[model samples]
Target: MVSAFAITRFASGLISGTLVDKFGERAVFSSGVFMVALFTFLAGLSQSYEQLLFFRAAGGLGSSMFSVAAGSVILRSVDDANRGRAQSVYQGSFLLGGIAGPAIGGLLSVISLRAPFFVYSGLLLCSGMVAFFFLKGDKIGKEDKNADISEHTTVREALAMKPYRIALVLSFIGAWVFFGLRASILPIFVTEELNSTTAVVGYGLALSAVVQGVILLKAGRYSDEKGRRAASIIGAQVVLLGVLLLTFSVNFWMFLLSMAVLGFGGAFISITPASIVGDVIKGKGGKVIAIFQMAGDAGMMVGPIIIGAVSDLFSYRAAFGMSAAIFVIALVLVYQIPETRNVEGPQVKNLRPLDEDL
Candidate 1:
């Protein structure tokens, strides 16, 4: 089941941005949200494992579309100075949903196995409608369609820029540790290493989500007003500290403290990459956004397998240490990228034509 979702996400991530470029952010984003809602509802109705997997895969594809198109719209709509803050708000909404969904699902599960899925489907559809109506001026209007398409930068052109490359690397590393290991390995670490209960794990995650929500507001403003490099470096170092603390944690309290630190790091890490891309792109950057999303998705898919292997071969401490090492590497890369906040570059000009090759 996990593999089906992961594989589909990775695959969809590659093309979703192109779809955004060809159609429009409003269309693609709304459609993706609607697809997710529809497929999730279908999944709930499935009686067989095969049918469930199919629906889950479809949901993954929908997620890919939603992420890429939403990111493109957010980046393009905001000015250079406010891009960081804009991304923060977008990311915060997702985190808020993550926090709410599990609690709602848990409650609904008591009524029936499929009740939560049906309810969530309705919620997603409502979100889609909101996106369709509220995300104004993102679609290339009929009068400007040809000119907009001509002005948009292709994936190849985006790759030639240094900031995009740096952002991609940071995103891949961030997703690997924050989404992959945190979701899959942390619970095991709490249970086996700290001799804690699932309730403790749940509380720790809930606490982290709350902290992340609060800190993201400050982090986004800091990145916009200060500099992306500085904010990202701080974020990576903080995450490394959290990983180090988690590596040595022996008690439930220590584990909870580490979760708080990790949450703080997540505040900076989650939105920085997308904002950086916004810094580098001139206009609708569908292909570049798609590639960036794909890198993060790939990391999420791969991180668990690597962490699990490390835990099996050595120990859970070793797995945690490996994650810390990855953060340190990301920190070094963050330092190498030039500061993008409030700085104008060639990429800030009108979008260029597509490279003939791609």
Candidate 2:
């Protein structure tokens, strides 16, 4: 069931991006949210596993649509000077919701197994309605009227740039470690290797989320002020340290420390790569943004399987060491890419011409 949703979401991402580019973020995002709400409501009423699976998979289409459109909206609306802060706020909100969502679902589930679904569906419907009614469509591409032809970047053109190519890799690595390998393997490692309970896993994850959430805004501000390369190099190095800590950890305390480190470093990575993509496009490249989104989704899908296989064939330490190696590669790539901050105003016109090698 999970694979079904992931596959569909991955496959539909480009379609969502195209729609956002054509219709604008407000319309596409609202329509996507409404579609998700309808499908989720149907899922709650499913009488069989097949029906539930079908509804869930169908919902992935909407999920991809809104997710891509949301990224498009952020890229289009925010300027280079404030883009990092904007992305940081966006990520921090997502972290807060992620931390709270399970708890809310648990409470709803107490009423009935399907209660959470119903509640989630209703909330989504409300959100979609609010967005459709209140969001200003004119703000998304307000600068497009005066945008030079060079301001519009195609996916191929974006990929040709060095920073953007590296940004895609960084996005993949970020998702691979944080969303995929850690989520899938950490619990098992805690329970089986460290001899800890599931409760310990939850505590560690909660701690990580809390730490990440608390630091996200500061990280964003730092990226805005210090430049993307500075923030990304620092972040990648810290993440490397955390993964190494995880690799060598022999007890619960060390594991907890590793999680905290991962969280702290993750906040930097979470915002900077998106900011880089936004910088490259200068706030108008739906197809370019879509390809970037697809890279992370691919990481989320592939990372667990590859890392888990290493764990099964070798050891948990080996699996973590593998993750550390990937982080090392990301750090090197980050170092090679040029700083992508403060590239707005008069300098914007020279961006493409400067990257003539691409």
User: By lDDT, who's the top model here?
Assistant: 2
Off by over 4 Å in 1: 138-143, 148-150, 343-358
Using alpha carbons, what is the TM-score of model 2? 0.93
Tens digits of lDDT, candidate 2, 134-223: 777544523344446565788889988999999999999998999766667889999999999999899889988999989998999898
Give all TM-scores, in the order shown.
Answer: 0.93, 0.93
Worst 10 residues of 2 by lDDT: 345-354
CA-lDDT, candidates in order: 0.84, 0.85
lDDT of 1 by residue, 111-217 (tens): 99999889989998998999888877624411245464546667788899888999999988998898777777889989988899999999899888989999998
Error of 2 at 21 (Å): 1.0
lDDT of 1 at 131: 83
Q: How many steric clashes between backbone atoms does each model show?
A: 0, 0
* lDDT at position 311, candidate 1: 91
